[model samples]
Target: MSGFDPRPLLGKALDQMGELITTTDDSQRDLPTPCADYTVSQLIDHIQAVVRRIGAVLSGQPFWSVPQSIESTDWPADWAEGRAATDAVLADDAILTREVQVPWGQSDGAAAAASYIGELAVHAWDLAAATGRSERLDPELAAAALPAYRAKVPAEPRGGDIPFGPVVEIGDDAGPYEKVVAWTGRDPQFAA
Candidate 1:
């Protein structure tokens, strides 16, 4: 409503993740990621599902109406389809102020976009770490999203429906991206 736009930032982050997903080696599919119990292939499926579901939300569909998991042998095409759906709905700035219902609460387009930016940025890091592509990540995604995450999700009383663990501690050398993921309960030092 105040002319704030996080779409470009979200788009850039999503694009980075798309590149990471597309470039992941097939052999790495069974490898473990920083996300507990999620293999590279399973994480990729989760990213795809998140994309499709969020796109459905922006397109005014019920949140739970979309499938929870969408497997993909061709990640590039799957990513493109989700992006295309979101791009179509987000093309108009008018939607920025329009109200949308999310899992936690009702929010306008800009807030929804920022929230998703953080969510996907964290998942993107998971994908990168799972496939040894962490070095290719853009720090801006975490930098832009960290504050929103801190404001929205508390650091204490984790578990249950919260879906996040206690914040992990990182060293002095940790970058913004690392800190952001660490804040979300991921260990930035994880390797595939």
Candidate 2:
């Protein structure tokens, strides 16, 4: 495929997540999500960390060099800042040609950005499910991310250190968001 510009899709996914975050109540922080190990709060924290790390990669910094942590309070504000920084970095076309270190190893910037786009989109759905908010994640963005996810993520076990579980089965007719989350091993029907 031609070079994929993930910035627009990333922006839409982040915006959808921002809407979902506002609907989250403090009472629901401990609620379970599709990711069996993570509570809603923990998942949100992870999303913020991923956003920051990806921003670092886009900025020509070593992605792992930045320490990742979630602020217990003011997480929404933290997410907004991270999103803005990531957006700014992605806006530069030069980033697409650069190489970045990601968890899977060194990859070109386009691949790295596409990976995060898939991650954020699926996690946004997880957060929405956990929080009992609307399940209407951006289908367009999900569809945009599906190819990269399918190409990179195998059907076999990804390993213990990998956060993703084995791919879950879903019907071929499933919607884009459902297909994306299922590819990440999340049951689309799961709720807190």
Best by lDDT: 1
Worst ten-residue run, lDDT, model 1? Answer: 54-63
lDDT of each: 0.83, 0.78
Clashing pairs in 2: none
Error of 1 at 4 (Å): 0.7
Q: Candidate 2: misplaced stretches above 4 Å?
A: 1-3
Give the Å error, residue 108, model 2: 2.0
